[model samples]
Target: MMNKHTQVIRIIMIATLQLFALRNTFSQATAQRPNIIYMMSDDHAYQAISAYGYGLNQTPNIDKLAEQGVLFKRAYVTNSICGPSRAVMLTGKFSHVNGFTDNHSTFDGNQQTVAKLLHNSGYTTAVIGKWHLVSDPQGFDYWNVHPGQGDYYNPDFIENGIRKRVEGYSTNLVTDFAIKWLDQRDKSKPFFLIYQQKAPHRNWMPEPKYYHLFDSVQFPVPANFFDDYSTRTSAAREQEMEIARHMTDTYDLKLAFDLPKESQRGLNSLWTSIYNRLTPEEKQKWEEAYKPSNDAFYKAHLSGKELAIWKYQRYMKDYMRCVQSVDDNVGRLMDYLKANGLDKNTIIIYTSDQGFFLGEHGWFDKRWMYEESFRTPLIVKWPGVTNKKVVTESMVQNVDFAETILEMAGLPIPTDMQGKSFVPLLKGKQKGNVHDALYYHFYENQEHKVAKHIGIRTDRYKLICFYEKNEWELYDLQKDKSEMHNVYNDPAYGKVQAEMKQKLLELKKQYKDPVPEIIP
Candidate 1:
């Protein structure tokens, strides 16, 4: 006859042993999978990062991937806008298939995501920081996202379905939560994390610590800062994004903020709202940093091209300051991984959602299929796999992100996804270009006056069709890299233009995209 308590103790001991056995088995299985950390920043142009040799500013932390692993020179996005670019990468599909063609579209949350596919493959997934997608993240084990476009200073973050305000700069707070999640993740399972940055976006705001980072340097003005756009289309000449005419005094230049509410215009309210979001200490520090410069700008009374140049300098300095914090935090993250012994078994990637114009063509926002906006910065580090300090000109696009991650992790890519895996490119198996041509489409027409269009880019030529206006433009990269002169009517390019048009139509049909009836 056994006592009841003794019997219960025996059963409990058996279960505990079984649990430990299961844990050991899981750890052994997951140890073979490489951990992945994907870091993406908003509106960060390739020209701003010194690793690209654009000579604007230095980003040592971001440059580390290029130094240690591989740098992609011809990387681009399916759509060159914020929300659509992210959506395309997430679903591994084009904007039309995903139903998120622009900022106005909502992400279909019920659809399968790359995160969901990875989770099914036994990886613990987490996404922290800016998620411009309107829906709450699905299939991620943990997520803390900023609402809407996200404020740059003292912002609010929504964590695990609960909204809370964090008391620090957006970059610092986002990084803190990301590291904290890594510290708390299940060690027995491989992890995938997306560390999204909100810095270097429009109306740039820097951390108090980096306010004086670029004070000593006077950035050079771009050669085409005074682009006449005389030979361009109606959309190019009518845009409201020029630094000279569109960038307001208070909103962009930070000159004045004391105007009466009734007198201020729509853009003027932006300055007041951002200033109001800060705490007392933050507000004081911001005023201290900009007050002297603002006073000097007003007293100088600069006008015309000189005033435009002055505003460009102010904008660049502020934008670069924000970029500095992003690089600093990237260093912190890499350090953490190195210290934790995760560096050797992890794959690191650094990229932006899309490209941005830094005083290029005298424009600010990204929408057109122009080179500045079409080409994004891409750097990847696979610790023991990739060649060190290699630069590849493979024509990779953002839609390939999902399938690439899956292939790297040895997981099966879903058939619904439109992107093809570029793992062979990373493994150094493919010598020449894997893609013969790339297709592009833009849907939004009202914002910034960028007209809707479709185009194609090959090795030596580019062709664009503004179907709505029944117009076309062609560029020969070997001759006109600036894309200033439209060569559509030039008899010299007649054959090349026709070939690109046929290929563009073929790509549209292959990708299941609807062609416009008005196309020429």
Candidate 2:
């Protein structure tokens, strides 16, 4: 009954209204979601990264993230070990709460995890690479993790109840798997990806291809490479992980040595067998690296102490060479993200299972609450959300990582989580402090002989009490950054130590830590 032009006008108006409604819905959905990517490295340290002022190594990609976002200077782990730290990061709970107090304690997959929370909130969650926790990983839509520490070459990955041994270096393979998963993920929703790398860890064995890469340079030993462990607590006196004396030759570590004629023949045979397993190119590179060190050892007629120093230098050089490969791979990941246009949207994070001693305090591995072992490297990049080139001196615990991720994702934090959200600190809105003090507990009485110790670290002081020994150690971090002096016995700092001890008590009660002994 109506004219054709009138009917056409009515149809156009209806279409316009529908389009407006659709636009409003889409904007609301997009505003609620933000993509997150968390990348962690094994045994990576703040002191080793060039952005944190390590002169010997260059990590341009890691530094690039720092250039674009916030670099946290005082990031500390709850327990400075592999399994416990990872558990804390995933659950936002302390080791005792999560029941992962040591490497021996198995993680209960039934417990709530960040991945589970994010996935339940409609985010695609994936974890690719080194999962040291004892239980099977839960809450991930797709999971591919290394079996135990994993191998530098030909690592095995457990994928969906199937363990498949894959060839290629662990770092490259992990990255490849992560990228493949990313490509296949549903693009309509936001994602949470954990790309963990097993590199520069203990025994310090690099891929054969990277052996000759740093051969031209001699990496200097740490300034405190020969610490005497004097003027400190008794715990410092018991560690047996020295880089020079403890490294085994069976692990392909570079060592300068001389022995009896018969022993020399045996050594030659061992080296020959190890070399035979390598490709021709690898053999060539190994020979080039060993030749000069061998010549120097024979030419010097070294004895006793001088011989030990030579071995230390060789070990240090090889360790740094392994780290060189890790740095290169970091650059590779950053490059991939930038090339794919995901770098701007993704929140890049870099850290480690725990910090390791690079010849500091004459220690090699980590299990202690010492600064070198407890402090980890933490860098975050969130494009256009935070300012560039800013350093936050606020205290951050590894347990807070889970809550921070949830906060950034706009999800309600679980009530069981003991950590506070650090999202406000990252956004540059929280001015006062993220945490007034951080609590630490390590129950793994491992080879390091480090006793079960619980402590609290404030901005100015550290108070630690060894439970079994019933002893305490205090240090003023503002004055003694290296923790070279223990002031627990000093009468002058009695009041200060008492205050810190009280604070430690308060934290223990708040967190419901089981081993609570009020410091007198």
RMSD of 2: 5.1
Instruction: Provide the lowest-lDDT 10-residue window in model 2.
Output: 252-261
Q: What TM-score does each of the candidates earn?
A: 0.94, 0.88
**Residue 186 in candidate 2 has what lDDT?**
82
Candidate 1 lDDT trough over 10 residues, lowest sum: 511-520
For each candidate, how many residue pairs have backbone atoms clashing (under 3 Å)? 0, 0
CA-lDDT, candidates in order: 0.86, 0.79
Instruction: Output the lDDT of residue 222, model 2.
Output: 62
Model 1: residues with Cα > 4 Å off, grouped in runs = 1-27, 518-520
- lDDT per residue for candidate 1 within 1-520, as digits (tens), equals 7699999999999999999999888778778889999899999999988899988899999898788877888888888998999898889999999999989988998998888888887999999999999989997999999998888877999999999877788998889998999999987789999999998888888888888988999888778889998776776787778888888777777777567888566878877887788878777888889999999988999999998888888889989999999999999999999999999988998899888888888878788888999989999999888758989888888889999999889888889888887788888887656567888999888768888888888878888888788788888887877778888878987888788888888988888888575454
